[model samples]
Target: MPTPDLMTAELTLTGRITTASNATFLGSIGEVEVVYKPIAGESPLWDFPHGTLARREVAAYMVSQVCGWDIVPRTWLRDGPFGEGMVQLWQEQDPVQTAVNLIATNQVPEKGWKQVLEGQDEDGQMVALVHEDSPALRRMAVFDMVVNNADRKGNHILAMTDGHRHGVDHGLTFHSDHKLRTVLWGWLGDPLTAEERDGIDRVTEGLNGGLGRNLADLLSVEEIESIATRCARLRLEGRFPAPSGEMPAVPWPLF
Candidate 1:
């Protein structure tokens, strides 16, 4: 649950993150760092309803909790300097860690990494998109599948020193339609482990309980149901799904 201090604290904005598409602020509550995305600053999208991104973000966090993977950082909705928005505890990723990378096509290692795609760069040099084949990253891929994440770009994954991976920028998630755009398709046909199956079971169980009620406040009836649908579909398949929509499989600006 989001603490009242997060909503009532004097949020002091330290800077604007120019890289983000929507207005994003770096702020602090006493000593805790947080990222704020005001609802007013969100640009309209043809596919998504207006001013609902913040709610989707909070919903993603709630689902993350149900899975017990800690794939997403703590997130909540709150009133901020710019108005009501989504606030998430900022994770300080390990600067030396590289969970995802683009490297020369020939340089891809045979083990410990999964190559996603190979393409030519601006200068026509061949490069391959790859990510570490670690348990932490694979768990994040399953989480993305459950959430219907539409923008799981390389930069959205934060690598930590303790080998944990955190996913961010979940505003483009939970849509009823099949709108999964991501770079984590390395496990397209891999079988789900027993642990992974248990995680999905936990999510299905959560949908019928408190988690369902909490999501009702943030998402539409159809969107909430779609979450259950996606979970059931994934569990039935028992493997990472291949892209099946007309839209591109991966987000642009892969890194």
Candidate 2:
């Protein structure tokens, strides 16, 4: 049998995800489940222009594809029950697996994980911020840097049953300024692997081709140029960078 056209299929709203700051829905396109965030429901942000978050979400997916990282899930813009929105294929994450976590400072694992920072929790107990030391997460960090991802919370990193990691909620991306705030800072100042370097090279090459043309529709010329510049800088540095800016390097309520 032929596959159904998800973009044009009738979308049925099964439920709403009330926990989201923006309006988000759990819906189905034919038999396929998806998470829908309509542009019309996007709240106004002081830093980002209105009615553009959905486009940014799609743009992040495009860059992920260009980099061959598969970090973001399959996402596209389409009309939904509310209005035009960003619809992404829902991924079933492994219930017992998480890419990052908060653990007591003394309980931090000595290997296979990277400690990002140490701080006190609500009860004033010492806690540590850490993430899995894996290539999948490193790729996500690289992707975030290129996109200027402003809010990469710990929970945004989904660990799938297949062991692949996926990053989601990319509405706060592509700002021309250096607004990268994320939880995956474990690789700070570490050298990039050859595969990671190659991925960056692929993104840079794509910018001069179809990827650049596609992004032109979703991002400003300055934003696109900034992405190219970031790739170049990362390549030249050949290492994961330490966060540097007036803003906090990590997002609040990290999870």
Candidate 3:
């Protein structure tokens, strides 16, 4: 059988993902399986506008592509069983590999990992948040900053079997305000590498052209401007930024 054109093929809902906060579904289009989050099913949020989450997801994908990082999977907005929504190619993450981990404070590794923070676990035992130190995750961290990702939960980072890292669930991104909540604070205060700076430059340049035009349809002018400003700021600072603002630095439940 021929492969389906994901962009235009009819999407059939196979099952509902009950664990999701919003109405999410497992869908198939020809030979491909996808995760679909319909706009009509989005739970209203005080900070974000109603029904715009799907667009934000797609916009994040576009920014990821422009940066040439491929951090976000193939995502787009299309009509589904409920209505127009965000659809993304499903990735099978390596079940055994977790990019971020919570280890006992005394058991934290001495190498190849960055300790993000230390806290007490539910049992009041000392624990530390640590993540692998690698270029893939660094690129993802930069992507999150550029998008102003407000919810970068640990589970959102998909560790692929082939060693690639993919970031998903980007609906809470591109807010005009500074809302950079995430569990990937391992690189906080570190200097940006040359490659990372180049990626930021690429995004900064693209925003004035095709990227800017495309985002205008999905985000308000202020939000688009904010993204460009973030790129510029990151490039100038050349370092990972520490968390600010009254909001928590990490997403609740972390995972």
**What lDDT does each candidate get?**
0.93, 0.93, 0.93
lDDT of 3 by residue, 32-124 (tens): 999999999999999999999999999999999999999999999888888889999999999999899999999988988999889999999
The TM-scores, one per candidate, come to: 0.97, 0.98, 0.97
Which residue pairs collide, candidate 2?
Answer: none
- Expressed as tens digits, the lDDT of each residue in 1-255 for candidate 1 is 454387688888999999999999999987889999999999899999999999999999999899999988999998889999999999999999989999999999999999999999999999999999988898889988889999999999999989899999999999999999989889899999888888888999999999999999999999989989998998899999898979999999897
Position 203, candidate 1: lDDT: 90
Worst ten in a row by lDDT for model 2 = 1-10
- Report lDDT (Cα) of residue 69, candidate 3: 92
Using lDDT as the measure, the top candidate is 2
- Which parts of model 3 have CA positions greater than 4 angstroms off? none
